[model samples]
Target: MILAIDAGNSRVKWGWHDGADWASIATVPLIEFAASSDHINPFSITHGDPERIVIANVAGEGAHQLLVNWTSIFDAEPLWLHGEAERCGVRSRYDRPEQLGPDRWAALVAARAVHTGPCLVVNAGTATTIDMLSGDGVFLGGAISPGIDLMRFVLHEHTGRLPLQEGSYRDAPRNTLDAIETGCRHAQAGAVERMHRAMGGNPLCIVSGGAARSLLELLRLPSRYIENLVLDGLARIALSERAVTR
Candidate 1:
């Protein structure tokens, strides 16, 4: 079995694969992931005894240390994914490949595997990332901006008037709570539209991450939402690496 973990700024997503298919999936708060004792029990779940573990973590604080400690409990060496020139059927076009975020790289790999033709992968999480992949598999650079929660956080933190607002999952804003929600929604929607236009009109857009559904509801363009894309990408990477070694 392969264990795939995506440790982002806000959440930790995990998936278990048994060589044939993804057997189970779960998510937890980022801060709670390392402290959760339940994860240490290999036989506690259906997919028992993960042979390999892969992780894509963007949080720089105690995240790495915690991940290393947690994986050590299972006597597994967790593979920390990083941006590279080429890996898992996707290549980085950045001048300094190492500078690219692992989250984005993993998304690219997963996007190429699941979708055909040119694609724009929009990850709306702690930080919104828009990445473009060419029809022929070339990875073109995209954009990044403050995500929904970040925007709301900034509004409350930096200003005295704007209250800390919770994200609304609904489509239309009706009241004050909805207004703040809609603001964040439009903020993301506008960016997506701009990127879509810059990429030469329409492309197959794939939205993922915590804020994916909210952004999708606000946007006018056609899109498909896939949760745990980073974990899926990690799974793909593990499988690809195994094939190479064989």
Candidate 2:
């Protein structure tokens, strides 16, 4: 059994894989865990212990230590993944390969494993990252921008009148709230379309993260949504020959 953890900016997601497939997958908001005084291993209650545990953390050192403390009961020390020059059939083209985000690296690895052709990997979370992978398993770099929530947050924080409110998407928004919502959503979709066009090979966009559904209807390209993409990639890395703790 292998436990793979993705400690992202806004949430902590994990999956339990039994060599072949996932036995269980779970997600928890960072705030929920942070606020709780008792840091019990939530998954262990239902799924029991794992023989090996691997993690890809992008939530800074504080969260990293929190996770270390939380998973202390497990027998295996958590194997933290870092972006490498090449791993699991995917080669990095970035000048500073190690500087690439672990979540993005994991996603690209997962994309290469599943798709042979050109791929546009989109992870729409607290911040959105759109990465391009070539047909021959080469990661050709990517773009990063504020995600939907961050867009909305900046508008509210930077401006005096804009309040943090939920509004439905509208093509031609008449109200202020709707306009804000539409503009943010449009920004996300537009970036994706531009990247897809720039990638130039009619790449299969593998969409994941919390805001994936929001962009699905807006995307015009051939896109597939995987709910637990980072987790899947972590599992693949856990089983790979090159998977090592940094």
Candidate 3:
């Protein structure tokens, strides 16, 4: 079996895949992994001794060492994804390819595997990122902005009047809560609409991550929601590399 881990700023997600299909998946507070190893067993969580473990972590505050230690429980070497011009099944066009986030790369890889046309992948998490992939599989650059949570956090942190609140997609905000929700939704929707315009109106927009559904509900343009695309991408990369080695 293979295990794929995506360690983000607010949460950590893990997926397990047998040779033919994904068997299990789950998400937990990032703090769980920071706990003592005796508190939870990595091998027990996956229910298998993972042959290979791949991680795409953007929240790099001792997480690398923590993962390294956890994977050692299975005696498996950890493969940390790094940005590259090309790797697995996707190519990057970032001016400095190394600067591209591994999570973004993984999402792009999954987008290409699922759709064979020009695509705009929007990942809404700690930071919202929109990445474009041409029909021929060339990764054109896209955009990045604060995620819904971050935007709300900034408003509360920067101002005394605004309180930190949850974000949602609502057509009409009748009250103050609704007003905040509307603002966040509008910000996300506006960014997506701009990308749609840039793509010339005929590209597949694939939204993923925790906030995908809400963003899709607010946006007027067409889009598809894909959950756990990063894990799928990691699985694809691991399987492809495994086949090549054979």
Question: Best candidate, lDDT-wise?
Answer: 2
Q: After TM-score superposition, what is the CA distance of residue 102 in candidate 2 from its true location, in Å?
A: 0.8
lDDT of 3 by residue, 1-246 (tens): 889999988788888989777898888877876664655755466476887788899878687787776777786777888677987657888999988888998888889999988889999987889888988888889899988888888888898788787744456777765678789878987998898888774898999988888889877776888898888888887777788879
- Which parts of model 2 are misplaced by more than 4 Å? 242-246
Q: After aligning candidate 3 to the native by TM-score, how far in Å is the CA of 144 from where it should be?
A: 1.3
Instruction: Assess candidate 1 and give its lDDT.
Output: 0.82
Best by TM-score: 2
- Candidate 2: give the clashing pairs: none
Off by over 4 Å in 1: 34-46, 167-176
The lDDT ranking, best first, is 2, 3, 1
Instruction: Point out the higher-scoring one by TM-score: 2 or 3.
Output: 2
Q: Residue by residue across 100-163, what tens digits does model 1's lDDT show?
A: 8988999999999888778899999999999988887778888999998898888888877878
How much RMSD separates candidate 3 from the native structure? 1.7
Better of 1 and 3 by TM-score: 3
Better of 1 and 2 by TM-score: 2
Off by over 4 Å in 3: 36-39, 167-172
lDDT of the structure predicted as candidate 2: 0.89
Model 1 RMSD, rounded to 1 decimal: 2.6
